[model samples]
Target chain A: MSENHINISTNQPFNYCLHLADNSLIMGHRLSEWTGHGPMLEQDIAISNIALDLIGQSRNFYQYAAQLKGEGTTEDSLAYLREANEFKNILLVELPNGDWAKTILKLFFFSTYQYYLYQKLINSSDKQLSAIAEKSLKEVTYHLRWSSEWVIRLGDGTEESNKRIKNALDELWAYTGEMFLPSTYETEYAENNIGVDVSSIKIDWDKKVNEIFEEATLPSPNGEGLGVRSFGKEGNHTQHLQAILKDMQYLQRAYPGCEW
Target chain B: MILEKNISLKKIWQILEQITDPEIPVISIIDLGIVRDVHVDENNVEVFITPTYSGCPAMDMISMNIRMALLQNGFTNVKITQQLSPAWTTDWMTEEGKEKLKVYGIAPPVGKSIDQKYLEELKVECPQCHSKNTKLLSQFGSTACKALYQCQDCKEPFDYFKCH
Candidate 1:
């Protein structure tokens, strides 16, 4: 792995792939934090399993990105060695996991976005991306279903659970806007039929989320007025991302190309 | 790029059939439907395999195991390539593999993963007592490939190799 970061701007497809990869990697990392501390044994295992799936998906994307870069970069380098600013993940996934409700809500929101995104990506003109999308779509479908059930359970269960989930919805609603707003690379690739036009999926995403919320007996937070503020896809991220990087990149950074 | 043939493709596949999943030792990788294809071009051999799950830890081990198994069989030029297209589904698991899972105290996937039925609705018979009176404990289990379930009759909690 090279110590120098590869100039992602040189390659549009690479940037597009990184956006998808980073989202999964960061989301998977956040979910892995709850590995041992889940509310129960079953839930713990469930969250960990989901995390594993996301991480696995990220690996696929990173491997694709590395191949695209074709500059001696490997998936490990792309994942562990890249600076936080080089990441193209959306801000929503990089946010702190507040509570169990927050985590579940976040997973619900992200998986819903991914569910729709991968659906479109499966038809990408790019063969590798399409193949990856086809494979990952199955896993994302499972994730969306699992998180939806949890959201419904939390929202409609007890008073306290309902309150926490609603709070989670409100807290995370602001970050949802950026997912639909395409970055420069995304726009270019989407125009070429190589990447998903995220804006097109918002309606479906909204409908599914609203239906899930309704089933949970929870009122949907109004995301219409919440303008997109942060752009993690544009290499802009929250302060929380650096902290995540600190823990995640520590091994590779400290040891300088260490491997198990 | 062409060279004299050293081993038969049939012989290489016969070696792969001996390698079992590291996580689930009861079933061979061939029965699990992961070994997608095997191409033997003269002295070079390439095995194409697909992962059961995206983040399955066993894939790396499985790849290594396949290499070692082939190497032991005198095929030193083995190359393992992972192919993701068409994806993998539990529907591909052989009937013999499903029986092996049951005999190993694990329930095999009962229905197609594309089914709309809820986990509770799936009639996953208990591996221990072979009783239909079983309930889903969790959608996820000890690993990414399995779900947790318990038998109401025999009171044994077992793993169900989830339908992908």
Candidate 2:
């Protein structure tokens, strides 16, 4: 793995790859925060397992991105060395996990979005991206199912549970719109058929969300005002991302090029 | 040279057969369908393998074990390539491997992974008592490849290797 020097002016495909990789890395890190603090033992293991899967998926994308750059850039440098402002992940994943309800809702929304996105990405013009998407789609399928069930369980459960889940939804709903708003790299690659145009998948995402929300007895948030805090994909992020990067990158920053 | 290459290829396959999954020690890597193909050229050996799951921690260990196994067999120049295009599926798992899993107290995948969001009505018989009256405790288990299941009859908790 090459040491990550600041190459912010890289190609569109490279940026697109980082967008995908950063999403998984941050999402995995957030979920891993629940490893020792899950509500119960079984659920603890379950969420951690999912976190492992996301981290693994992020590794794949980061490795590919490094290979594309080919100037000694490695997955580790790409994951650990990049500045917070250089990250292209959506704001939804970077938000703090408010509670179990919030975490599950975030995962449900992201995975459902990924479900639709990967469904199209599997057919990407780039064979490697296609293969990665194909492999990831299966895992994301299980993620969507697990999170959807949790949403329904929380939304339709006891009165207290229902209230908590509703609060989570209200807190999280504003961030969901950024998922479909195409970043510049995304727009360019999608035109070439090598990347997914997220805007195209918004309808399918809405339909699935509606279906699950209905089953969970939760009202779906209207699409209006969803992107009030958008543009995370353009390297703009909330303050929470800086805090997350502080924890995730502390070791790498303190001990540069250190290996386990 | 041709005869030597064929011999090395066959020997490599046999050596791989001796390497079992690090997590599920009962099933050989070859039987589990992780070892896709092997090729030998002069003294160099290239092995093509696939990951069962993207984040499966066992894959790194499996690669290490393959290297050690090959090194022990005097195949010093060995390379392991990950082929991810045609993603791995449980359908490739050998019948013998499935039997080994059952005997070792873990239920093998029942059938093809439909890869749909909806849960399929797949019946997982308990390896302890051979009863299909088992309930899924969770979609995830001790590892990424297995799910936690408990038998109603024997009341024993076991791992079920999921179809994916």
Interface RMSD of each: 1.3, 0.9
For each candidate, what is chain B's TM-score? Answer: 0.92, 0.95
Expressed as tens digits, the lDDT of each residue in A48-125 for candidate 1 is 999999999999999999998787889998989888788889998999999999999999999999999999999999
- DockQ winner: 2
Residue lDDT tens for model 2, A1-260: 22223445434378888899999989999999999999988899989998988998898899899989887999998989888888999999999999899999999999999899889999998888888888888888889989999999999999999999999988988888899888778888898998998989999999999999999999867656365645788888899999999998999999998888
How much of the true A–B contact set does each candidate keep?
A: 0.82, 0.73
**Model 2, range B19-89, lDDT digits (tens) per residue?**
99989899999889988888888988899998888888899899999999999989999999988878888
Off by over 4 Å in 2: A1-12, B114-118
- Compute the lDDT of residue A220 as modeled in candidate 2: 69
In angstroms, how far off is B99's CA in candidate 1? 1.1
